[model samples]
Target: MRVDLFDFELPPERIALRPVRPRDSARMLVVEGGAAPFADRRVSDLPSLLRAGDVLVFNDTRVIPAQLEGRRGEASIGATLHKRIDLRRWQAFVRNAKRLKPGDRIDFPQGVTAIAEERHADGSFTLAFGGEEPVEVLLERAGTMPLPPYIAGKRPTDAQDREDYQTMFAREDGAVAAPTAALHFTPELLAALAEAGIASETLTLHVGAGTFLPVKAEDTEAHAMHSEWGRIDAATADRLNAARAAGGRVIAVGTTSLRLLESAAGEDKVIRPFEGDTAIFITPGYRFRAIDGLMTNFHLPKSTLFMLVSALMGLERMQAAYAHAIANEYRFYSYGDSSLLIP
Candidate 1:
């Protein structure tokens, strides 16, 4: 389908600069797979929205401070680590590429430095951090949280974003981007959800910097989807399968979790142990096998995320729902409000 089909008008004011106080207080637009008018709710109200037997799947991948500002021979450069190749080397999208070359050593803040070992065909570089210690330590000292460009371009990432960007379930660091939908979850909310008998589980999908890249293709078929590493352990898979066997709805808390679940699931809809990369590009006409519903944030116009949601619901329905969201003053983007999409 033409990428233009997913386009929608969104005013600049709707873009969230920061998260609402008391994370669970953010607004949630409840869109069911029905003709019912969209319901306005709060993130805290998630427990009341589903049955006790339903399961909420969350992404546990932690966000790393992957955004770096550095210099190579007096030329200012910026890099966002995209994927990890090994213990010390990372695939990164670099700014000021014209000034960098193979073997160039870039100096970052906190005495951290890396050598641009190779440039890939897609314009990213293989950066090998110069250190004997773990790269996470170096990042903690020198890097800032990798906020999406939609937010970062409007304002500088600050100390608040360090806390705001991470989900409560965040652990196992690797992701450059936070699974934003989970940002709405809080300890109190989790307690409430558990008390209400809404079960939850976690999987890991190291959301890469590539998630923020725009779809440059005119058609969905031409778009080159970026890959991210994900995992589902045997125990977790067994639990999820058992939940479904008991007639429970499997709800993915974010697209990251949804994608990984779909990638691990077989034609019979059984989820299995998985540990590898997934570049699943979900679009309309795609049949979902693993998830019964999704909880996600409002996405950018013409974005792959929007396309995925459209696939879960319908193109026309999502278009109408977004129009409703914008008109009702719902926040948008990474630090924005939440939406519970049931389709």
Candidate 2:
């Protein structure tokens, strides 16, 4: 389909610069599969909106401070580490890349340095740290939170972003971007869901910087999704399958979780143990075999995420739902309001 079909005009003011004081206080737009009136709700109302037998799958991948400002000779350079190829090497998108070349040394703050080992066709570089210290340690010494350009361009990343950009379930670190929908969840909301008998499970999908990349493709067929590492253990897969066997709905809390689930699920709709990379590009006309519903943040116009949601709920319905969200002053983007899309 034409990428222009997904385009819409969004007012700039609707982009959320920061999260609400209490995370669960954010607004949620409830969009049902059919022609039901869109419901204005709150994140705290999730328990009430979902049934007792339903399960919510969360992405537990933690956001790393992947943004780095450094210098090579006289040229200033910026890098956002998106993927880990090994213990010491990372795939990063580099700014001022024209000034860099293979084997060039870049010095970052706190005495951290790396060699620009190779440049890929996609314009990213393979950066290998120049110390025995773990890459995670090097990042801690020199990196800042990798905020989405939409937000970072508006304001500088600060100490507050270190806390705000992480979800309650964050544990296994790797992701450059936060699974924004999961950020709306809090301990109180978890307690409520537990009391309501709504089960929660976790999977990992290190959301990469590619999530923030714009879809420059004129058609959906031309868009290539960047691969991200993900994992689903056998125990978790068994539990999810059992839940579905018991007539429970498997609701993915974010597109990250949904994509990983779909990647692991077979044509028969059974989820298996998986630990590898997934570059699943979900678009309209795709068959969803794993998730019964999704909870995610408002996405950018003509973004792959919007296309994923459109696939789940139909293009026209999502377009109308987004129109309602905009008209009602709902927040947009990574730090924006949530939406419960059931299809």
Which structure among the candidates has the greatest TM-score? Answer: 2
The reply for model 2, stretches above 4 Å from the true place, is none
lDDT of 2 by residue, 1-343 (tens): 9999999999999999999969999999999988899999999999999999899999999999999999999999999999999999999999999999999999999999999999999999999998899999889889999999999999999999999999999999999999999999989999999899999999999999999999999999999899999999999999999999999999999999999999999999999999999999999999999999999999999999999999999999999999999999999999999999998
lDDT of 1 at 282: 99
lDDT for model 1, please. 0.95
Relative to the true structure, candidate 1 reaches a TM of 0.99
Task: Estimate every model's Cα lDDT from 0 to 1.
Answer: 0.95, 0.96
Of candidate 2, the 10-residue stretch with the lowest lDDT total is 133-142
Clashing residue pair totals per candidate (backbone < 3 A):
0, 0
lDDT of 1 by residue, 233-300 (tens): 99999999999999999999999999999999999999999999999999999999999999999999
